[model samples]
Target: MNRRTFIESMGILGAASLLPISCLHMQPTTNYKLGYQLFSIRDEMTKDPIGTLKLLKKLGYQDFEIYGFDAEKGMYYGYTAADFKMILDDLGLTVSSGHYGFSGFLNAPEDILIRFVDQCIQGADTLNSAYITWPWIAPEQRTLDNFKIMSKKLNIIGEQVKAAGLGFAYHNHGYEFDDHNGQNGYDIILSETDAALVKLQMDMYWVMHSSKYTPKELIQKQPGRYVMWHIKDMDTKTRDYTELGNGSIDYTTLLPDPIASGLEYYYIEQGGNFAQNSIQSATDSATYFKEHLQKYL
Candidate 1:
């Protein structure tokens, strides 16, 4: 089904009956790390990163995942990698992963792509990020041949990032699941990329929104391939952003096998529509996480 149709057809499930039967046996893990994606509150971050980070830290977040890395400026949210690292250090937070745009890899000259990757590796190293993630592929760039080319480019980039002593991962949206000749872009990505050199940052919301697979099934199908998770929820009615525990996704079923999924870090992220204020949403989500989800982590 197309994305729009899927979203409209999937009505919101009430909180009292949201958990799926599959999640009944799932249990939490003590070894997991909980983090917040900066994108969850991008407005606050863009205005005052230090203040924003301090607020998040105070709200009980211990780790961070950054997005919108500017290669030209060698910065994230207008702070150089070194500066950003220092700020995070002072707040007692560490960056686990950062999303890096891949348009350069797709459209830039060969030399430019190499330089971009090199710069990204250096920046990630400075921030002590465990993973440098390729976060999005523009819709116009999603053809079958483009997927093949992107897969090859990702392998090369992954090898370079691996050599730099960091992991490389790709984040997905529902579009990657688009069917092409009995296969899909996601299938190509999985088969063409070197699993040893590249890992996946699974966005559970998008996976579910695709209406093609469940997070648990994907974890089982490609064990050890996913290293990080973007922990967001889908509004039962709109299929849009919502805080964890309030949405239709059942973390109870998915968090049972972190070992099987190779999940080390999971970050809370709400794309745009916060239930209340951003800070309040984050605070509420964190509270729900500690009270409901922390035990399973």
Candidate 2:
């Protein structure tokens, strides 16, 4: 059977969950294991980082993707990188990847660029994550020339991070989908960057919500460049963030070409509407993916 057929055959096994390990026809790999970017849990984290990590573990997360590690603070939420790493390790969770904002470096004085880059490098290295990302672009810097400038600088930033032994990526939001000279900024980033040196972390929700392109089309055309993906969902009525599979995206079509798309990790993100709080939002996403995504797998 083909990969898709094999997955479809399982169809949400009930006996398998209770049976011995050997009887299982499907064993999820790290590739398919559900993970959440800590930013989705940012509010809970601000309240208590250690408590948040414990809660996420209880909610069935084995992998994590983090953001906003202020080097100055020496901790993300009053927990040092070493301290935070220990907490995750004890819970059998791994920090798969994270967002590393480079706008500060891109906008800082020349003398301060290296300092900012070093700070990012320090946090990424400390966490042992595979990819560090520049999360978004400032609205005012939307001109074609600025896009080119951003690309050149990102390429430079990729080189610097790669030299430090970590991969570099750009994470998209809806703004990058807007047209400039009838071409999008995302097009420029894709065309200008060296694929070997840089990777793209496709934010599927933003691409779908803002642009006409679908995630599958982007992966098909840009194969091997998208190393990570933000698996966010959007409600059609409000165009706002929602739980996975509870929104309009067709994830079945999206995951089948994982290898072709060069995807290593997929991180769940819900920008806001943490009605119950961040950990609860994460648990809802993880639970949804576990129960519903298998059909699509």
Candidate 3:
């Protein structure tokens, strides 16, 4: 996916749990796995994937959701799937999912789309990733008509991914919540895609920023279908991305029941608007989450 458009498109789009603020804020705890999307530290990973993973692991992040798989080369960060997996293994880190570039095929022919999806599936298998996620569509393709077509393709892709013993999910941004007359793109996605085949990867920041429904209410609409989550906080004044606990979202009350949401994994992500720098933002978010938000998940 194009990281610049990932932020700039009309720009859009936002999960969770309940734990009292007083009860939280404890010393760093263990046993639970916290995930961070590598896209948050894309620059660092590009320069030094090994060093970046090592630092993120030291910050108490155990699970990861990766982005920008080079489908043509069948590589990630210039490393083959097996090699990358080995890197994570040596670092005591796990990558359960990834944001692949499937959105580019939104208008491509079936055969082309299938070819790309199959490539993504192979990469996922090599890494033992449980899910291959479709991150975002280009802004021009966000029309209601395209969403309908997108939903159909989602089912087809989901069927193929599921056949390979993996899960398929669509990650939402603010654009999906844009009102198209009475029906929004998200509505079409939820209503048209088969729940058994296509799962939802709810980005809590976009849901809150763009959608009218609260994260809890959105899950209530289709509870078990949501298999993944992108957890990020929104800047209070500019509505941009900020480090966790330094933004407007109130996870203490906003996080939905894990059981209700079919919550499998959640990743802390900030595409842009970092407080200091990307790596520091990742470390800061990790610290904030361990102290304040880990218990809720």
* Highest-lDDT candidate: 3
- Superior by lDDT: candidate 1 or candidate 2: 1
Q: What value does the lDDT take at residue 66 in candidate 1?
A: 89
- Model 2 lDDT tens row, 48-145: 88788888888877777887777676575677888877877787788878776666566666557667778878877887878878887676777778
Q: What residue runs in model 3 are displaced by over 4 Å at the alpha carbon?
A: 1-32
- The alpha-carbon lDDT assigned to residue 265 of candidate 1 equals 84
Q: RMSD of model 2, in Å?
A: 7.0
Q: At residue 154, what lDDT does model 1 achieve?
A: 89
Model 1 alpha-carbon drift over 4 Å, by segment: 1-30
Give the runs in model 2 whose Cα sits over 4 Å from its true position: 1-31, 294-297
lDDT of 3 at 84: 93
For residues 1-297, what per-residue lDDT tens digits would candidate 3 score against the true structure? 598977665354310124432234233233447999999999999899999988988898899999989998999999998899898788888889999987789889999999999999999999989999989988789899999999999999999999999999989999998887788999999999999999999999999999999888988899887888888999999999999999999877787766678878889999989989998899888888877777777
